[model samples]
Target: MSRYAETYASWRADPVGFWQQAAEQIDWFTPAKSVFNPASGVYGRWFDGATCNTCYNCVDRHVVAGNGDRLAVVYDSPVTGQVARYTFGELQDQVSALASVLRGLGVTKGDRVVIYMPMVPEAIFAMLACARLGAIHSVVFGGFAPQELATRIDDAAPKVVISASCGIEPGRVIAYKPLLDEAIDLSENKPDHCVILQRDTQLCDLTPVRDVDYAEAVETALARGEGTECVPVDATDPLYILYTSGTTGQPKGVVRDNGGHMVALKWTMEHHYDIKPGEVFWAASDVGWVVGHSWICYGPLLHGAATVVFEGKPVGTPDAGTFWRVIQDHGVAALFAAPTALRAIKKEDPKGTLIGEYDFSKFRTLFLAGERSDPATIEWAQEKLDRPVIDHWWQTETGWAMSGNPVGLGAFPVKLGSTGKPMPGYDIRVLDDAGNAVAPGTLGNIVCKLPLPPAGFPTLWNAPDRFISSYMAEYPGYYATSDAGIIDEDGYVFIMARTDDIINVAGHRLSTGAMEEVIGSHPDIAECAVVGKADALKGQMPLGLFVTNNGANRDESELERELVQLIRAKIGAVAAFKHAIEVKRLPKTRSGKVLRGTVQKIADGESFKMPAAIDDPAILDEISAALKAHNMIGEPV
Candidate 1:
């Protein structure tokens, strides 16, 4: 039997004691006066009055423990046909040298540094360097539009901006220097210096006095033997400020503390992922995302596990088998990726033939997050890889998994439709509009009890008021997850959809995610998205858009008819799922989340801002054309 029940009960019994025990794994300069201070900032603070250095815990401590030769990072870039590896010792040298350079540039404790670069080892070094100096780092996704980057720059007011000349895509090179320059020009807050890493794929001109060559600066620092040591900081000090899109036009900076973040992420590396020291843990996500921050950079390093910095797409990075090749080559133990990636690979290689090309003997569990994992994708991955396809739920606010099957605790039974049970420290509850408990298996708002566990954001950077209003205002003593889900009698949590994705269909509430799951299960369909469109009589109706699998040639009309029938049979006629359109592809964010809200706005003939994280602006036009061809666009209300 799994130890999940006993472990969870232990945490529930003494949340502070549980986290305090986990804290012993990290190397702290000063032990906390109190494991938790209920009178601390916002909801509360963990490890109050402690002192720690995140960079030292992640890098230096490993060397001091005689594990310097152990692999730390594996940089695999299929797009560039390059591979590089670093040990704990090499990582320490790199991070310290860069920290010295930043210190020379006047970046001190409490200052903010903005990192805007591609998936290169330098980006990781930049983040660690900032932490070494007790400075906060904010990583903006490379190639973000100038306006979006400018907004982040204004909000962060960074003292220095570290970026690259360009980022390489499947068939093209995106020049990032021009975008960074334009963003700096557009923003009111200007950094004192800009460090640019010039990639061989593309070169850029740098402005004198403002732009600094990354290699030259690092080489000088190394040659002079001016490596900087880690600076001790309060446990409550901010480690990084990650900006997520806000409901308002501005971006909300999610603040992560040094102490709680290290303890929590280190615990997850062993418990949630079942990864051990020296094992290879690959989180196939960009550094700009929370997954990259926690898993790819910090979590694995803190646990002494090797992390993979992959710079390629799930497909078209040569072919659909790239992921398997990397896993086999690196001896990856656990791999975490978004569901959209699996869908893309499955669409290109429908028969799972590419997976057989590589021997992934070391690969263990496959974790899926970022977006809801439809049962179809999970089943396909499980069948092809013959491994557990664990779908966990988390957000940018929470640096680690909220609900997941604890593989190290012997893993609970796999429930295809549910995102497992709540992990330790998360007291999940389903509540109605009045904040009352809802019946089992009934859809309602999902929330967690007050005083969220460690690694969760304490407050929005410079905006505690906004944090309260955005997340806690509506649910009174609870931290509203803003997700609509159900809990079965067995205690499995089924996250059906975002609260906004729930539709009122003829006075009945229906989940678009449920409809998408059924439609995606059809053999011909590779992936699908369901959105609730405006309907005059029924308040709202479900609209389905899907892409077909490779080599699947069926009449569009027949496929549409089949999809409609499938939904009706599965969800009954209450779904009103009449409109099903086959498209070349669905619009998605760079992180691979479907832009359903944007699609809904377009279908309703309502104007919507261009999403900052959208993968391709052109995909919106394609979606619009498809809606127009099918006469699905409704008049603007």
Candidate 2:
């Protein structure tokens, strides 16, 4: 039997005592006066009155404990054909020198530094260097449009911006310097200095007074023996601000504190991921995302494990076998990625032929997040790799998994459609429109009881009232997750869809995610998305868009009919799932989440802003054309 029940019960029994024990794992300069203070921030604060340095806990303490020679980071970029490794000691030297450079440029405690660069090792060094000086770092996605980047720059008001000349892709090079320059020009808040890393692949001209060469500055600091040490800071101090899109035009800046952030992420490395010191843990995500911040950079280093900084696509980085090659090249113990990635690989190599090309001696677990992992994709990965395909659920606000299988405590039996049970510290509840608890297997809003566990956001940057209105005001005492889900009698949580994705079809609420699951299971379909379309007769109807596998050739009309029949048979007649369309590909964000809302807007003939995070704007045209061809476009309001 899994020890998960006992561990969760222990946390629920003594919430403070549980987190206090977890906090002891980190090296703290000053112990906390209280494990929690319910009267602290917007909701509450964890580890109040403690003093700590996140960089030290993540880097220095390990070296001081005589594990300096252990591997700390492995940089593997298939796009550039580059591979580099760094030991804990070497990583410390690089971070210390960079910190000295930032200190010389007048970046002090509480100051914000903006990192706008590609997936180079220097980006990781820049983040750690800022932490070493007790400064907050905000890393924007490398190739964000100038307007989007300008919005973040105006909000964060960073003192120094560290960026690179360009970012290399499979068939092209994206010049980042021009984008960074345009964003600065567009924003009102101007950074004092801009440090640019000049890559040999493509270099750009830099402004004389404002721009500084990254290599020259760091080399000068290193040669002059001007390395800096970690600065002690309060546990409640903000470590970083990650911005997510908001309902309003402005983005919501999510603040993560230093103390609780370290304590919680460190605990997750050992427990949720089952990663140990000196082992390799790869989170195949960009540094701009929360997954990259939590796993690729801080989590593994804090746990004294090696992390892989991969800069390549799941496919087309030479071929579909790239991910397997990286895992085999480095002895990866656990791999975390989004479901979109696996689907992309499965689309190109439908038979799992590429998976057999690599050795799996050191590989163990495969974790999926960022989006709902359809049962079809999960079963394919499990059967091919012969390993546990675990799907955990969380959001950017939480900064860690709220519900997952704790591999260290002993993983529970796999449930294909469920995202496992709630992990320790999360008191999950399914509530109805009346704010009352729902019965087992009943679909309703998912929420967690107040005083959310550590690592969760304390408050939004400069917007405490918005934080309350956005998340807490909905349920009075509980934090609203804004997701529609159900907890079965067996206590397995099934995340059906986002609350907005639930539609009323002649008074019956139906989940688009459920429809997608059934449609995705068809052998000819590689991936699919379902959205509720406006209907005059029925309030709304379910519309499906899907892409076929590599060699699957069937009449589009026949495939559409088959998919509609499949959904009707599985979900009953209330679904109103008659329409289906085959597309070249579905539009997605850079992080692999389908842009369903955008597709819905197109189907309704409504004007929508071009999504800033969309991977390709051209895909929207294709979707619009398909809708027009099918006469599915709704009358514009």
Candidate 3:
């Protein structure tokens, strides 16, 4: 047996002890006396009694260990055609200077500081600066609507807002300062100050009384010759508050603590990603999302690795070869991206010509997350790259991968469609409505047995009752994931779909994810999403919307028939998957999760509002037209 197997078994036997040992790896200002405290009536706390500064662990310690000269971050932007690298020492100094600036702005420990910047080095600097001062940083994804930004501002009520003047997109520049100004104008609770990075002075507005230039702040701090001290914070102090889309249409702020998050991410960087210190790690995600928070910014830094901050898409910024070019140029050992990204790249280059043009000898592994990974996308990628394309499952609530193939530990057996076994700290189960564990091969709700592992969201920011009712109340002693999946006899877990995403045909429940997986596997199809439409006799039926590969020559009607037949053959007739339509593109969020619910609502002619996180708002019109043309639903008069 592999040593990873031993480690898993030992962790299963003693989870608390395993995590306690893991926590010892970090240099804490004051060591923790207790590993976990759960009986506090609220959410459980981890690493209790510890005092540490997160910035010190991520930046200062690496510099002190003689790795200061090693590159800590590489900022690559295809939009601007610029490449910049920062060493550990340089990053620490920048973070320190910014920390001093925040202190000068009256930001003290526990104060909320909102970051509204693009995918730039300054964003990381702002995050670390907040950590250095023990202030909670809430980073909103750049380019969100003014109302959405205002809502976040009203919630966090930060004393300072840090942002750039503009953001660089594929063929355009987004003026972020205007949006920030408009948001603050619309907000009921205005921030006391605004710090703007003047990426474009021509497009920016400075409020003399309330705003300060980032360059001027840094220069002043440097001139003062003051070393900003890293304030020691309690182990359970809130590090950041990230808002994720909630079921009720209100965004819920997920809070991550300092010590537990640091410990868990460091462990994941080594155990899950299999990259050690000094190796390059690239997570192709935006900083607004949890993946970006955990992997892109903090995780790699905590593990002493160089993280690449990419400001480009998987395709069309330069071309379909963007990811390949980055991998080859940066020597990225492990790459994490959404499945939607791979699907888009595969659609544009079905023959993998783009991949063939690059030399990826340094690339070791490929991981997929954020959204569900279809077996077709995973197989094509793994075969094309000649490496393992691992698919893992976790949530924004959980900071890291809860179930994933540990590539560094050993070559675990690959189950193509399965996300892999639960990680060492997670005890996952598929439970029925009554909270009983379901038998193997039976679909049920996915839940994690309490107390949740370290690095997990302890509670919603300022809303402990919402946290309990949202996650814990559904299952008395478990964290209800609200996702539906099944566990195989061999313990491999397969996430079928979200619980609410299940389609009911007559009395049989069908998984849209399962149908999409089979449809997407068809050689002609590049990607697909399935939603349920109302049927006269069956009550509801599966409707698959798909994008074809570039070289597919079949007509839309013929391709639709072929996809329907393929689903019928693979998933059986009980799925009632009759309709498949060829669409130009499926609507997706900025993070690349397909908007299946929006598609379903349109098909059913139900009232539904488009989520604010949608990347392309006009895509909804295309979907509505597709539905009407196919007679799946009639056009609104």
Number of clashing pairs per prediction, in order: 0, 0, 0
TM-scores of the models, in the order given: 0.99, 0.99, 0.98
Residue 212's lDDT within candidate 3 is 93
Which consecutive 10 residues in model 1 have the weakest lDDT in total? 243-252
Give the Cα lDDT of each candidate.
0.93, 0.92, 0.89
- Candidate 3 wrong stretches, greater than 4 Å: 41-43, 246-248, 634-637
**Candidate 1 C-alpha lDDT tens digits along 100-165:** 989988999999999999999999999999999999999999999999999999998999999999
Candidate 1 has an lDDT of 0.93
Would you list the clashing residue pairs of candidate 3? Answer: none
